[model samples]
Every structure is written in C-alpha cells, then in structure tokens.
Target: MKHPKDPSAPGTMRVLDKQPTLQRRSFLRGGGLGAIGITVIPVASLAASKDVAARQSFRHLGAATGRTLVRMARDIYPHDKLADTFYVEAVAPYDAASAKDKGVKKLLADGVKDLDQRARQRCGVPYAEVKTEDERVALLKDIEATPFFKKVQGDLVTGLYNNKKLWPLFGYEGSAWEKGGYVNRGFDDIDWL
Candidate 1:
C-alpha cells in the first residue's frame, strides 16, 4: 500500500532488512524452521509434596506411637512451610532405635502413654488427638524434665538439623568451606537481618 502524496516506498520495511539473510543469521533464526512453541510438562511436580502421606513402620512402637511422635516433632520444631512427612522422617529415627534397644522402646511407649493420659485428663482426648497447640505444648512442658522428653528432643535435633535436604528450606546454603567460605561470598548480604 502506497500513499498518494509521499511515494518514498510501498513497503513498510526496507528491502535490505526485509529480505532473508545468509548463513550468518540463518542458524540463529533457525533457517526457515523458526522456533517451535513447545510446552513442557513434567511427570510429577518437583516442589515439596504437602499432601503426600508418610508410610511409617515400627517394630517396637505402635501406630499410635509413631503418629504421636510425628505430632511431637512438629510441636517442637514448628515450621509452617514444612510438611507432616518431614516430621515423620524426623521421628522415624526414634522408631529405628527403639527396634534395636528395648530400653528406648519402653521409654517411648511409656512416655507416649503418659502424655496421652495427661491429654485425656485435660482435653478428654489422647495426646495425638489434642486440638489446641497451646494445650499440647503445655502437656509437653509438663514432661520436659523427663528422660523421654530429653531423648526425643535430642533425636529431633539430629534428625532435623543434620539433614542436607532440609538446608535449602531453612535458607541455609550449606557450609561455606566448599565455596571458599562466606567471607568472599555474600556473607552479609542477608536483607532480613
């Protein structure tokens, strides 16, 4: 289309620019093929699985015992971003130890029973069934002096803190030794502080 008054050129683009180029730009422009619009979908989501149920098995501890330990682990750590599966994974070490050591098995079983009794007395439900976090925490506080409480707390520290996979969730980028230490890196780059 050309204007009646101005007859500079009919086409909007210049002839040299509009014309197809040679091998220099051919590879970049994909010759004549152009870029295909390909949408990629993965077989499964890579993000943390929230709804995935943890399959727990314990030789010495009962099903209720494992469930109670999971709840207790969360009550202690209390990370909102973390899932129940993580708590399950954390408390699983206790179950493994209990299988090998009868003393550990007894300690867990008796402690759980005692805590459940306290919950029943206070809220008319077992410890695992306790509705309020405040009340459950109160129950844990009451037993804080006990060996079982100390043992479980120690187990959780190992299970949670030592995990490399959980490092990213807590904003930890692992030890700085491998990356030539945090001094050279953005050691003070933290904006939240």
Candidate 2:
C-alpha cells in the first residue's frame, strides 16, 4: 500500500528498504544486534536502552502523562493541537511511570471520559474522533465556561498548565513570580510605545 505521505512508494514503508544487499544481509546476519547483545546482559537490557534513547530525544511535559492530556488539549486548543508532536516525546516517560503516579493518573481517570462525552454531545464527535479545527475549539470554550464543564476543565487545565512542556507550546515566555522565569525569558525589554 502507498504511504499517506509518499504516494509514489508502492510497498509498505521499511527503513531497510533503502539499503542495498550488503547492509541488509549484514542486518539479517545480526551484525549490529549480535555485537550489542554481547555487551548488553539481558533482553530487557535492550528495552532499557531503547527507553533511555527515547527519553533523550525530547522533553515532553503535557504528553508525559499520556493521551488524557492529548485528548483534553485537543478539546481546549483544537486549532493549536501540539499533542501529536508532544506525544512523540512523551511515550517513554509516560510508560516509565509507576501506578503510584497518583496525580497524573487521577487527572486522566477523572477527566477523560467526561470530556470525551461532552465533546461528542456538543460537536457530534468523540474527543478523540473530532476532525475539524473550528468545531474542536468551539467545544473547548464551551467546556471551559459552562457550569457543567467547570470541574473537569479545571482539573485538566491545571494538569496541563503544570506540565513543563506546555509553556513552549503556548508561547508562554515565563512568569514574573517564583524563580524569575520572567527574567530567563527576557520579559523586561518591552516598551509599549
């Protein structure tokens, strides 16, 4: 089947497809994996290596908790959906968390289902299912201002606002309070002429 991004390609996308016989044959012979396996102790060690590699690649605040934030953020700021990018960074960190991460887990458990239902009711699509930008944003504002939406919105936004990665996504240039985030972002230069 053709890749959505590259219609010209006819077969299934394969990273190895670009390589010639020697590299592919060596890979099949377990060239790299065999060497690494000798150095790495157990099969789980390889998994741990992958986990570390994933964490090193990006810093994800909102997505570190999982798809709950993605769903909520999509609901709230539909047009500026950064969740897809954030999710790429978050997968490892999110999977690393234990069951004891009560704060994030509760936030997801409490808000996701209701938020999804509200999104479906207001827009005729589930939170995860919505396709259009305008419909998503309108539903988000509705969820934020309505009394019925108050509790869940508060919880979800609180979690999102607290995420370390959210600031970059929102263009938050830091704050004047606590540890001088404002100074770090150089908020002192504005002259309102």
Candidate 3:
C-alpha cells in the first residue's frame, strides 16, 4: 500500500510523516526510551517491597503486644536515641554468656508468655488485641498488682535496663568507656555526688 506522504516510495513510510516537528524532535531527543521512561519502575517497586517487609518482620512482639508497647517505650525512654536499636536487640531470642545459663533465657521467655497469658485471662483477650488506651493502662495496672507480673516486670526491667542503649534513657550518667569506669549517677542525694 502507498501512503500519501511517501507515495513515490512503495510501502515506505516517513518516520515522522504526520507528527509535528516539535514532538518529533522531542521524541528523537529521548533516544527511543519512551516519553515517560522505564528505569523508575524497579526502584519504586523495591522501595514499596522493602516497606512491606519491614512491617512484616516485627509481626511477633511477644508479650509487649501491638505497637502500643513501642509507643510506651517511646514515652518511658523518650531521651534514648538508641531505643529502637536496643529494643530490637532485646526482643530477639536471648543469648547469654554460658550454655548452662540458657535456662535464664528460657525463664525470660516464659515470663513474657506468662504475662501475656495473664492479660488474656483477665481481659478475655491478648494485651496486644486491646483497642483502647485506657484498657491497656488498666491491664498494666492489673499486671503490676500480681506477684507473677512483678517477677516478669522485674526480669524485663533487668534485661532491658541493663542494655547499654537504655542507660542514657534512664538518666544513668555513666562514662561511655564501654564497661569499666565510675558511673556517677546522681539520682540519689544531689549534694552527695
């Protein structure tokens, strides 16, 4: 078939026969990569996937239950810049110094499990499942009143507070010498130093 723009040349079409020269010039300048381009897709997809993966990774929060604990940590340790860093490290499976002391690791796990179960039994739902802020606060109070809760809270406090990352958050003014120095914390008598 012969086209009007290229009638003299049988079956040959002018690449930019009917288009405006400006549009043609712009298209040619793009090096045939299409007007809007292609390299943007994978980068966008990867960013989205990374966000989803990060959310999914923290699905199991043990006894802490829901993002509320994270919020609580923020409130309790507001000044701690390494709160998240220490928290993630703390929430992971425990790794103590000795192999036989693995029992202590189990004890900590059991303590958290017991606390969560207590919350569920008292409230008819897991602590994480509670919707209202009042309910969460009330649940914490109930836990505090119990011996088991005291024990668990003690262990958790010990574990979490011992974290080097939490020292500054708790106002522990220790030297940052890693582990050997006078941590002259002035929480006691202000005049006593």
Using Cα atoms with residue i matched to residue i, what is each candidate's TM-score against the true structure? 0.70, 0.35, 0.37
Kindly list the per-residue Cα lDDT of model 2 for residues 1-193, writing each as its tens digit.
Answer: 5566674576645454554433321221212221111111345533444423223432232332344445443343232223344333333343334245666445444455666677778777666566765565555555555443454344434444555765654545455577756666566677763
**Of the candidates numbered 2 and 3, which has the greater TM-score value?**
3
What lDDT would each prediction earn against the true structure? Answer: 0.70, 0.44, 0.42
Residue-wise lDDT of candidate 3 within 1-193, one digit each (tens)?
5556774777665564675433321222212211211122234434444322124343333324323344333222222233243443443333332124655545544544655676677777665555654565555555555553454344445545577654554556656456544444333446644
Clash pairs detected, candidate 3? none
Error of 1 at 63 (Å): 0.9
Would you give me the overall lDDT of model 1?
A: 0.70
Worst 10 residues of 1 by lDDT: 29-38
Minimum summed lDDT over a 10-residue window in model 2 is located at 30-39
Candidate 3 is scored at a TM of 0.37
Q: Pairs clashing in candidate 1?
A: none
Off by more than 4 A, model 3: 1-85, 91-125, 169-171, 175-193
Comparing 1 with 3 on lDDT, the higher-scoring candidate is 1
Clash counts per candidate, in order, are: 0, 0, 0
- Give the root-mean-square deviation of each candidate in angstroms: 19.0, 19.7, 24.0
Error of 2 at 44 (Å): 30
